[model samples]
Target: MMNCIEAHGLTKQFAGRLALNNVDLTVGSGRIVGIMGPNGAGKTTLLKAILGLTPFGGELKVLGRDPWVSRDALMNDVSFVADVAVLPRWMRVSQAIDYMNGVHPKFERAMAEGFLSKTTIGREQKVSQLSKGMVAQLHLALAMAIDAKLLVLDEPTLGLDIAYRTQFFESLLHDYYDKARTVIVSTHDIDELQHVLTDAVFMDGGRVVFSCDMTDFDAHFHEVAVKPSDHELARTLNPLHERHSFDRSVFLYRNADVEKLATLGEIRTPRLSEVYLATISNQTLAQKGSPK
Candidate 1:
C-alpha cells in the first residue's frame, strides 16, 4: 500500500525539553489508525506537525510531499478536524457550509447538509449558539464531506454524546474510508473507537511507546476474573493488570490457559479500556517499554 503520511526522525522542542524525540510513523492509504495516549502525551503535537501548524525537526511527507514546505498543496488533498470546537462563531451553519465549499474543491455541500440533518442543528443557527456536542457534529459532518485523500482528526468526538459519537464514527467509516483514502483519528475514547481502529499508537511525554495493529489487540490481551481464593494463583501468572470487584477480581493477562481460569470464574475479552490500563501501567513502562 502507498504511504499517505510518513514521518522520519521527527523531533519537537518546548522550552528546551523534547516533546517528540526521533519519532517515526507510517500511515498507509485507506487505513483507520488511532493515535492513543494520555493527556500531554504529544498526541496533538504530532498532528500539528503533520498539519504544518508547528515547526519541528524531522522529515514529514504527506501524500509524498513535504508537509511543512508543501502545506498549501498538501492541504488541497488533506483535511483536518481538530479537537477544539473552533467553528467560525459568527457564521451561520449555512454560511460555514458555503465557506467550506469555496475552500475545498471537492467539498460535498449537499451531503454535508444532509448529514447535519441527522443532528439537531438548524442551518440558520450561528456556530456560536450551538452546544459543544452540536459543534462536534457540525465539524464531523463537514469533514465527512471533504474528498481529501487523507483526513486527520484530533479528539474528533470530544464533546459528542454517546449517540452522536456512535453515529459519527459509523458515518465516517461509511462515507470517508476507502482503499484510496486514509483516516487518522486521535481520541481518548478508546472503547468506542476500538471497533473501527485498524492500528493503534500509544505515546507518552512526546514519544511513542507502543505501536501495534489493532487486530492484535484482542489477540494479545485477555480479561479474566478469579475467585478470592484463587487470587494468589492468578498473581503468580504475572497478570498484566488487575482490579478487584466485590467478590471477584478482574485481570488482564497473556495466554494464561482458559482451563486454568475456569476455577477463577468468568473470563472474557478485555475491553479497550482494560487493555489500555494493562499495557499503559507505570510498571510496564518503567520496565518493558523504556527509552525514558
Candidate 2:
C-alpha cells in the first residue's frame, strides 16, 4: 500500500516540557484513520507536527516529504483544519473562498460553490456574523474544495448540533473521501465514526497504545458478560476493561483467549469505541497512569 504520511521518532516540546514523545506513525493512501485521546494526549500536537505548523524535534513526513523543510510541497498534497476558526471573522463567505483559491494551488472554485450551496451558508454573509457551526461547515467547504490527497481534520464536527454533524460527515464520506483521498480525523467521539472507519489509533500520554483495523475488529476483540465469581480469574489475565452492575459483570478482552472464554457467560462482539476505551483505560490502570 502507498503511504501518504510517515513519522519517525516525532517529538514536540514547549519550554523543555515534552508534549509529544518519540512516536512513529504511518497512514496509507485512500484510508480514513481516526485518532482519539483525552485532552492533552498530544492529538493536536501530532497533527501540527505533521503539517509543519509547530517547530518540533524528530523526523516527520507528509506525502513522503519532510514537513519541517518541505511544507510548501507538502501543503500542495495535504489539507488541514484545526479546531479553532482560521478564517478572518471579518471576511465574507465569498471572500474566504477567493482567498483560499489564491493561496492553494489545488483550490477548486466550482467545488467550493457546490459544497456551500448544499447548506444554508450564503455567499454574502460575513464570517464574523456566522454561528460557530456555520463557521465549521464553512471550513469544511474550503477543505473539500482543496482537492488534496490527504486531509487532517481536528474535531471538525465540534460545536455543531447533531443534525449538522451527521450531515457534515455524510458529506465527507460521500463527497470527499470516495476513492481518491485519505483522511485522518482526531476526535473524542470514537463511537460516532466507528462505522465508517477503516482503521483506528488510540493515544494515551502521547503514545499510541492501541491500533486496529476495522475488518479485523470483531474477530480480534470481544466482550463477555459473566458472573461476579469469575472476576478473580478474569483479573489475572488483566482484562481490557470491566464493569459490574448488580451481581453480573461485563468484561472486554482480546480475542486471543476466545476458546477458554467459552466457559464465561454470554460472549458478544464489542464496538470499536468500547474496545478502544477498554484497552486504554485498562492499560492506564496497569501503568498507574491517571486519565486526564
Candidate 3:
C-alpha cells in the first residue's frame, strides 16, 4: 500500500520554542489513525505541516508531493475539517454548498445536500443560527462530500453533545470511509474514538513517543490489576507505570511476560486511554530524571 503521508526529521519551531522536534512519521492509505496528545504537544503543528498551513524544516510529503511547495496540487487529493468553526458564520447552508462547489473541483454539491437532508438543518439557515452540534454536522457534510484520498480532522466535533459526536463518527464510517481512502483524526476524546481507530500515534513534548497499530498494541503493552500482596512480584517485572485503583494496583508493562503477570492478578487489554495515560506518565518521569 502507498503511504499517504511521509515525514523524516520533520521539525517546526515557533519563535525560540520547538513545536515539532525531529519527528518521523508515516501514514499509509486506507487506515483511520488517531493522533493523541496534550496541549502544546505538537498535534496541531504536525497537522498544519501536513495541510501545508505552516512552513517547517526537514522532509515532509503529503500524497507524494512536498506540502510546502505543492500545497495547491496536494490539496486536490486531500480534504480537511480543521475545526467546527472553519465555515463562515455568515454563510447560509445553501451558500456554503454553492461556495464549496465553486471553489473545490472535487466537491459534490448534491452529495453535501444529501447529507444535510438527513439532518434538521435547513438550506436557508445561516451557520450563526445553528447550534454547535449543527455546525459540526454541516462541516462534516461538506468534508464527506469531497472526493479526496486523505481526510484530516482536528477536533472536528469539539463542544458538541454526545449524540452529535456519535452521529459525526457514524456518518464518517457509514457514508465516507472506504478501502482506498485514509482518515487522520486528532481529538481529546480517546475513548469515544477507540473503536473507530485502526492505529494510534501518541505525541508528547513536541515529539512522537509511541505509534502502533491497534492489533499490535496488546503485543507491545500489557496492563495488570494486582492485589497488594502481589505488588512486590509485579515491581520485579519493571512496569512502565503503576497507579492505585480502589483496592488494587494497576501496573502497565511494556513487552513484559504476560504469563508471569497473569500470576500477579487479572490481566486484560488496556483501553487506549489507559495506554495513553501510562505512556505520558512514563515520559514525564523520564524527562524529570534526565540531566538538565
Candidate 4:
C-alpha cells in the first residue's frame, strides 16, 4: 500500500520544550488510524504536523510532498475538522455550501446538499442560529463532500451528548469512509472510537509508546482471568497489567505462552482500552526508572 503520510526523526519544540520528539510514523492509504494520549503528550502536535499547520524538524511528507514547504498545495488533498467548528456566524447554510464550492476544487456541491438534506438544518438558517450539534453536522457534511485523499479530525466530538456522538461516528463510517481515502482521528474517547480504527497509536512524553494494527494486536497481547489460586502463578509470567473485580482478577500479558495462560485460567483477547492503559502504565514506569 502506498503511504499517505510518512515521518522519520520528526522533532518539534515549543519554547525549548519538546512537543514532538524524534517521532517516526507512517500512515498508509485506506487506513482509519486513531491517535490517543494524555494531555500534552503530543497527539495534537503530531496531527498538526501531518496537516502542515505547525513547523517541525526532520523529514516529514504528506502525499509525497514536504508538508511545510507545500502546505498550500497540500491543502487541496487534505481536509480537517477540529473540536470546534468555526463557520462564519452570519453565513446561512446555503452560503456555506457556496463558499466551499468556490474555494475547494474537489468539493461537490450536490453531494454536500444531499448530506444536508438528511439533517434538520434549513438553507436559510444562519450559523449563529444552529446549535452545536447542528454546526457539527454542517461541518461534517461539508467536509465529507470533498474528494480529499486525507481527512484529519482532532476531537471531532468533544462536547456533544451521547446521541450526537454516536450519530456522528455512524455518519462518518457509513457515508465518508472508503478504500481510497485515509483518515487520522485524535481523541480521548478510546472505548467509543476503537471499533472504527484499523490501527492505533498510543503516545506519551511526546513519543510513540505503542502502535499496532488492530488485526495483529491479538497475537501480540493477551489477557487471562485468573482464579485466586492461579493469581500467584499468573504473576510469575510477569503480566503487563492486573486488575481486580471483587472476587476475580484479570492479568494482561504481552507475548506470553497461550497454552500456559490457558492452563492458568480463562484466556481471551484484551480490549483496546485495556491494552492502551497498560501501555501508558508501563511507559510511566519506564520513565520513572530512567537515568536523569
Q: Tens digits of per-residue lDDT for model 4 on 1-292?
A: 6699999999999989999999999999999999999899999999999888889999999999898888989999999888756677899999989888999999999999999999999999998999888888888899899999999999888888888889988999999999999999998889888778999999998998888897677787899888888889999998999989788799999889898998987789888889889889889988899997
Q: How high is the lDDT of residue 216 in model 3? A: 78
Off by over 4 Å in 3: none
- For model 1, the local distance difference test gives 0.83
Q: Compose the digit string of candidate 1's lDDT tens values, residues 41-102.
A: 88998998898888889888888987888788888888899864667789899998999998
Highest TM-score against the true fold, candidate = 3
Q: Candidate 2 on 205-259: residue-level lDDT in tens?
A: 7777788887678887878888888888776655678877788888888755887
lDDT of 2 at 98: 85
Off by over 4 Å in 1: 228-236, 255-266, 283-292
TM-score of 3: 0.97
- Tell me the TM-score of model 2: 0.93
Which RMSD does model 4 reach against the true structure?
A: 1.5
Please tell me which predicted candidate would have the highest lDDT against the true structure: 3
Q: Estimate each model's TM-score.
A: 0.87, 0.93, 0.97, 0.95
lDDT of 3 by residue, 147-246 (tens): 9999999989888889999999999999999989999999999989988998999999889998889867778788898999989989999997898989
Per-residue error for 249 in candidate 4, Å, reads: 2.2
Candidates' RMSD to native: 2.9, 2.4, 1.2, 1.5
